[model samples]
Target: MKPYIFSILFLLITSISVAQTKEVLLKKSFKVDENTILNLDLDNANVHIIESKDDKIHFDYQIIFYNYSRRKINDLLDDTSINTSKNQNQIFLKVKNSLYLGIDIKYKPNFDYKNFNNPINDVYKEYLKKYYKTYRKSENLYKTKDSLIEEINFSIGRDMDNYIKKEIDNFPLKKPLKTDKKIEKNFIIEVPKYVQLKIKALESDIKCDYDILTEFKMDSFKGIFKFKRIDGKNNQITSSNGILETYGIKNSRIQLRDMYKVNIGSISNSKLKLEKTKTKIGEIRKNVSINDSNSKLYLYNFGKNFTKFNLTGDYSEINLYNVKDTNFSMDISGYNTALNMNGTKTSFGASKEKELTKILQKKKKENSPFLGNIEVLLKNGIINIK
Candidate 1:
């Protein structure tokens, strides 16, 4: 009887552990106006939204685009297309033209209340005094009356004033009392295993009367896209403007921009039509043995006047278990360029011209456009000019 009882307790503990380790899936959508200057959609897109007690919200979305221009993606990532309050936190990326992407929200909650307690408060007060003394001395040495510098000094002073006021508000005046035991609910939504989504191109049967841009004619356009999955399967879906129906399965959200207009010379008596096709291949896996994870890859192709072109590329990525102190490599190849790096040896290719190469090489060494400390190497080029 004793042995049976012990066995039952062990089984119960195991069941609880298993339940805690399970993953959940969530889906939500926001309405977007089609006629607006920026027509974007998050419908059926896999998005991860998180809310925390720190009075902060976070959104992580995996987005893909179709029939959109690369310039539009660049504008959105540059924050030119969206507006937010001064104190808000925002981040955006155009992984692909047909796929406008971004993660925008307010700052995370403040956990500094812990510093207002007894021992911590004393340490903080001492540090503040030292900081102010050092800063003032440095300002005196500069001795410049430049308005910009003065304005910056004024802002710092105002911030210090606010800090003092906050401290006063948190001052404890009376002994705290223990109230009755009460239940408080806290909720957290873990990041999903997969954000599955699909996007179909909408075609209009009626041809509209429009002026053709002479500078933007093409004989053939071909390219490939690469996608990475954190937990589930990685796949690709392709579509063309001529297709009257929707095409492709997206495991995340899809954001489409406008068609990229190019200068393709004047229209002649002979009628010409442009054709494009994109092929996506298998997932790029890291050779190292590590825990499960996922990533994303983007490709942008802009062509010159009428010409036949062919492009090919491949990518390889390393998986990481502990990103805090681990080093990784991301390799990409296409259009006669290759990027290779470990921690420091990074390179970039922007254009066939020497001037552009120098500019891109400089941008590569700067901070990563993303919020992390990863190094980047960018190589870009154009082809088949008439």
Candidate 2:
């Protein structure tokens, strides 16, 4: 027999009788243009959207409220809902939740609204004022603004709890009202095909496989992206730390920027704006072309050959592979560069070179241009074009 088994059963029965139920939080539709820009920004919610043949965007949202003790005036947690606003061709949606330290306050104790001068509250405010006057004067003596706000909130919460407990005879004590940590909503949305999409999510995965005649943009601060395919338009994706996958891609203006890693399958259309904060190529499928800023691009077996690459910024590497009758061109300028290509013609020069009359009475020969070129410019970083 386990200790406190009867007590545990009693507690479970009590909780089951009083646990808050889930309900539909928000349900609304707006007038949308034919080619719309659907923007969704959330703190922490898994967003799942599939393109249907419908004309208007359909949203179905639900939330689970916890830590709410049933009291008088049953409208307790009804004010917390998502906001939807619209402009000309853009529709913005947002849900503020506890993911980013958002507080969920419960009001079970009788509010002292009639009695305005609360002794407990006055004592807490007095202490807060004294501390503010002593330690929080300067504007530029801290590390970050966010840290300052967090510190002030901590001070207020501690002081209030201590003061209220001391005056418990006069002031009623309050139990902390907190939502469950599993507070993300299973958000669902459906929209038309010809629309641009933008989302800002935290700790969620974004999977976009829509291939229509429109542009797509997503700035995921802490989430990852799964890009399957794209049509004949532009696509921009940015992430903090996530893996990206794009398989069937065609003539599109694509920009894949990340602070972590990217994986691609087949990409065409010599318009790739790639920027990676790390100094390594995560993965590439085949014949991928990119106008890159910085990263080590390791070229293995050209999956679908004829990959063109143009590079800029610091400490980049290019590992090249040779095929039959495949001519290549490289325009590299930097302080230190490493090119490791066996059985390949190599050339290098400083952009600040002299003329014939000033130096050797002859100009440096230019190599015949190829379909794929590696043009580089650097100041004090290694340009590894292999």
Candidate 3:
């Protein structure tokens, strides 16, 4: 078999496979009311659930957490939450139906910490060691050195202030504590107060709408095949009878081709009004004024060269209002070729020169050597002997 033939066959197979195995990604957010129990299975890392609530809101949650990685739950928790003290690390409670006014359960890297090595203490001790070393060295130098040492001490003090400020800025600031204390006499100020509670309740079945979003990359091939229109209404199609149609040929390349026929049936009180605008190629516009109350449009594309072919079709249906102010036009061209062998070499030639000439004459006449060459090719082959 020829290389081009194999290439075309492989393209058809790949296109069919791709069409069969295509998937879509969807992402959405939903709001749940307060006091709702959420049962989540965290077996899949791609799936997650989060909860939030106001003062009057309460919620019970049952989640089966799974760690696909080799790391333990404690390690994951430690990574997710910040630990300020060397000896103290916040522990996550695990039980069925642990109720809370608000609960957020998604993967948290910093909070997943449970191990022999305490990162918080290790980091603080390193900082303290550096601070003490610098301070002690500077103090000793101030006592031993001359007047230049005073300037050095001043610089050291400024450096220490800046370092402390930066460290303080790095620390996470906690929210201020709220309190209510009534004073006996002198000017008592009144303030509103609300309390939130976290409670534990039994796990119950709840309807959960799960939405998954994912993206996959796969290798595939693509090809263009011809499609035929089975039915039409209110308009006449030039290629209505079963015929091979091609559109737009540039540099010996067929831009578009339709292997199927186009058929347009009768329409009642049908009118086709087209308005055209000048473009780089030519005038282009919208086609309106064809309205059929009871009619259907049938279309199909046929694949050749291979027994079975995959087709991907996309169509845009435009509904136009007010035909008096509408514009539309169409430009189509193509090449039809037949292969012939003269001696040992094979040549390709077109088979529709006179037909194309008649069609072109109906639209517009353009006298060009390029078209004349095409006409000659249609009569003979790509090559001819005198």
Residue-by-residue lDDT tens digits, candidate 2, 1-386: 66699879765654442345465766777666667788888765555577756677877776544543333112433434478989878999986544432222221223344455755445445545754665435321312223432332232122333233344355343432233321334456777776677777766655554654566666666554455465445666556655444444555555555545444444555355666633222223323455556654544222323444544545454443332233544455554443334434333332355211111011222463344444555432343222
User: For model 3, what is the error of residue 347's alpha carbon versus the real structure, in angstroms, after optimal superposition?
Assistant: 99
The lDDT, on a scale of 0 to 1, for candidate 1 is 0.24
Better of 2 and 3 by TM-score: 2
Off by over 4 Å in 1: 1-253, 256-338, 342-386
Displacement of residue 206 (Cα, Å) in model 2 is 1.8
- Of candidates 3 and 2, the better by lDDT: 2
Give the candidate number with the greatest TM-score: 2
Cα-based TM-score, every candidate: 0.16, 0.52, 0.12
lDDT by residue for model 3 (63-181), tens: 22222122222233333211111112211122222122112212111211354264544544555577677754653221111232232222211234334444544533211112211
* Model 1 residue 160 distance off true place after TM-score fit, in angstroms: 25
Q: Predictions ranked by lDDT, top down?
A: 2, 1, 3
User: Between candidates 1 and 3, which one is better according to TM-score?
Assistant: 1
Write candidate 1's Cα lDDT for 55-142 as tens digits. 2222222323222234333343354221112112222211121122322111111223534564544545654685587643542221
